[model samples]
Target: MARHLDLEEQEQLDELKHFWNQYGNLITWILIVIFGSVAAWNGWQYWQRRQAVQASFLYDEVERAAVGGDAARVEQAFKDIKDKFGRTTYAQQAGLLAGRVLAETGKADAAKSALQWVASDASDEGLQAVAKLRLAGLLVQAKDFDGALKQLTSGVPREFEPLAADRRGDIYNLQGNKDQAKLEYMKAWQGFPADSQYRPLVEVKLTALGVDVQTLKPAGEPAKS
Candidate 1:
């Protein structure tokens, strides 16, 4: 009976060895891949957090320079932020702030350059829209009317549509196209909600065009006869 039990144990051992030989390499590789992926994900999250913290510090530097009215310092800090963290939200905010400071300091060309970079390269759609709108205003001030029109022609986010229409109306008025200007002003007036402060501004535009804001209905709404 003892000899028989020994033979049974040897048979079980041999089967276990055969199973390991068949699948050992594949099982080891699967575990390695799963653990490696988990480690890589954790590392990526840590890196992104570190980058955001660093970028935020750089943005604060740009803001301080801007508030101090030190254009040179603002420019240098903004340059560093853009070079190191251009993909971060802090970089985009810095671009907008820098553009404003540069424009206030009579650096129109530099302001346009900064705004153009944000308009062209910002990852956020709303930020891009704001950049484009500001760039269009700058172009208008420079009397680059055609260029201003080109800037306004690009798609803006929905909340900005009314503002864009109003700007287009201003451009048309400048170009002596009163009829088109009134049409755009009408669109702008209709686009805003009744209680919006901006709606009253649009009303002023329409009033200047001999169109009574009280007489026009919102777009797509049926007019009462």
Candidate 2:
């Protein structure tokens, strides 16, 4: 029985060696790839965390400068944050903050630059739309109606569609295109939620354009209580 057991163990050992001889390189490469992927993922996660921490510090500086109403300081800090962490959420916030403060301080060109960067490059679609809307507002204030209209063209995301339509309506109205203005305002009014406070504002614009919003409600759907 001892001899039989020894023979059995030797067979198992021989089978293992044969399997290894056939596929050893493949197994080794597979393990290397799996471990390499895990290491790469871990490294990427660590890098993202580190970047977020550093970006947050700079964003705090931006907030402080904004609170103090020091536009120049806000712009400089925003530049630093954006340069170092352009892919971070904190950079998007800094851009918006710096844009507003700079615009308020009468630095229109710098404000546009910041807002334009956010509009063009933000990973968050909502932030991108917000930047475009704000940039369009700045262009409008500068009497660059064509530029404002161009900025607001499409890509505003589904939720921001109403605001974009309203902006376009305003521009059309300014340009004395009453028909187009009415069309855009109607779109804005229809897109607004019943619970939205801003709906009334859009309604006012629609009314000025001689639209009867009551007629525009979906058939058989009751207005909000």
Candidate 3:
């Protein structure tokens, strides 16, 4: 019985040796790859966290400068945010605020630049559309009709169509194209919903153009002409 037990133990030991000899290198490589991947993932996560923290600090600075109405300081802080955290939503928001403040402070050119950046490169489509709309309005104010038209050409969200059309009408009116202005005003009227608060404004525009929307309404719902 002692000899049999010895033989069994020897057999088990030999099988383990064979298994190790067959797969030892493969097992070691698999472990190394798994640990390396884990280490890389951890490193990437740490880097992302650090970047977000840094971006947040810079965004706060932008907000402070904006609130104080310090255009120069706001510009500097916005530049830092754009340079360091351009991909962050905070940067986009800061850019909008800076653009608005700059325009209010008689820096239309600088405001256009900031709004153009947000319009062209912002990750959020809605924000991009807002920037484009505001930029287009500024261009219209500056009498850059061609540039304003170009800005309005891009496809925007459904909610902005009326505003775009209305702005286009205003531009056409400025150019003394009353016919084209009426056409755009009609389009704005059609694009607006019945319950929209802005619908009345569009109606007023159409009225000024001598087109009564009430006469254009279909049945007996609301005068969305």
**TM-score for all models, in order of appearance:** 0.90, 0.94, 0.80
lDDT (CA) per prediction: 0.90, 0.92, 0.86
| TM-score result, candidate 2 | 0.94
Clash number by candidate, in order: 0, 0, 0
lDDT by residue for model 2 over 123-225, one digit each (tens)?
9999999999999999999999998998899588988988899999999999999999998887787788888787899888888888878777632466543
Per-residue lDDT of 11-63 in model 1, one digit per residue for the tens? Answer: 99999899989998999999999999999999999999999999999999999
Q: Kindly report which residue stretches of model 2 are placed more than 4 angstroms away from their true locations once superposed.
A: 218-225
The predicted structure with the larger TM-score, 1 or 2, is 2
Number of the top TM-score candidate? 2
Which has the higher lDDT value, candidate number 2 or candidate number 3? 2
What are the per-residue Cα lDDT tens digits for candidate 3 across 64-87? 887898888888998998998898
Q: What ranking emerges by TM-score with the best candidate at the front?
A: 2, 1, 3
Residue pairs clashing in model 2 are none
Q: Which ten-residue region of model 1 has the weakest summed lDDT?
A: 216-225
Model 1 spans > 4 angstroms off = 1-16
lDDT of 1 at 169: 94
